[model samples]
Target chain A: GAGVSQSPSNKVTEKGKDVELRCDPISGHTALYWYRQSLGQGLEFLIYFQGNSAPDKSGLPSDRFSAERTGGSVSTLTIQRTQQEDSAVYLCASSPTSGTEAFFGQGTRLTVV
Target chain B: AQRVTQPEKLLSVFKGAPVELKCNYSYSGSPELFWYVQYSRQRLQLLLRHISRESIKGFTADLNKGETSFHLKKPFAQEEDSAMYYCALGGGRGSRLTFGEGTQLTVNP
Candidate 1:
């Protein structure tokens, strides 16, 4: 892809339901990132991936939130037993390497009702 | 841990007016700072980075190590410059990027 791509531009799920968000980073990019954008909290870092391994997952809010990247390209973020507080826009970004400028996707707006 | 802070949530200015968006970060190690902007209905994109010292779209940012600040500035603001701006900090290799709360700038005509 020319830029980072995220699927299901918008999503609505009920409490206790599970939701999956996807991200397809630009070809040959080795670094990927995930973030959550909320009303006042701003962009909260959720995870970071280098190649197919995630070295930084400290930003994951809770045990319910998990993510994985495969083939050093596509990534998936899964939220189990979603809560209303989880309503926010999930953003994905990719960079050629660590410490470089990142390109972001349109983001996936996840609304948990 | 590295953290970025953007104090202003909203900023407004008239066209051709000078504008400055403040950004501060706290990190023990040398950090990489960047500014990202998102216009209405568009994806977030990198505006400039402190390391490059290059200006984009008339915007420039300087990294002050002593003050731990990387503020974005423009002499004359244009209406097209209206957007949400974010300050980000990177902790070098194998580090994750941390973003600030963001500042929403509105350059009115």
Candidate 2:
């Protein structure tokens, strides 16, 4: 892809339901990241993936939030038992490598009702 | 831990006026800094990076190690410059970016 791409631009779900957000990073990019943005808030770091090494999951807010990147190209973020607090925009970004400027996706607006 | 802080939540400026959006960071080591912008109905995009030392859309940011700041500035503001701006920091072994609370810049004609 020319830039970072995300799927299902908008999602509405009931509390306790599970939701999945997908990201397709630019070709040959080795670093991918996921972030959350709440209304009137900053971007919250979630997780990061670089190559096949262990992902840095320190930013995940809770056990219900998890993410996985397959073959270092496509990634998926899964939220289990979503809560009202989960209603926000989920953004994904990719950089050619670490310590470089990253390109972002349009983001998926997840609404937990 | 690395952190980014944008002090102002909202900034209003008139067209042709000088504008400055303050940003500060706290990091133990040398870090990469960047400014990202989000316009109405548009995706977030990178406006400038410290390492690049380049200006985009008439915006420039200088990373000051002594002050631990990366403030975005422009000599003259324009109506199109109205948007949400974020300051981000990246360092350590991970590729994740730590962002500051964004500032919404509104330029009036």
* TM per prediction: 0.92, 0.93
Q: Which ten residues in a row have the lowest lDDT in candidate 2 chain B?
A: B90-99
Chain B, candidate 1: TM-score: 0.98
Candidate 2 has a TM-score of: 0.93
lDDT string for model 2 (B1-109, tens) is: 7778899999999999999999999999889999999998899998988989999999999999999999999999999999999999888455467789899999999
DockQ of 2: 0.60
Cα distance off (Å), candidate 2, residue B56 = 1.5
The top-ranked prediction according to DockQ is: 1
Per TM-score, the best of the predicted structures is 2
Candidate 2's fnat? Answer: 0.58
Docking band of candidate 2: medium
Q: How many backbone clashes does candidate 2 have?
A: 0
- Judge the docking of candidate 1 as incorrect, acceptable, medium or high: medium
Model 2, range A1-113, lDDT digits (tens) per residue?
A: 67889999999999999999999999998999999989877788899888888999988999999999998899999999999999999999998887567899999999999
Candidate 2: regions farther than 4 A off: B92-95
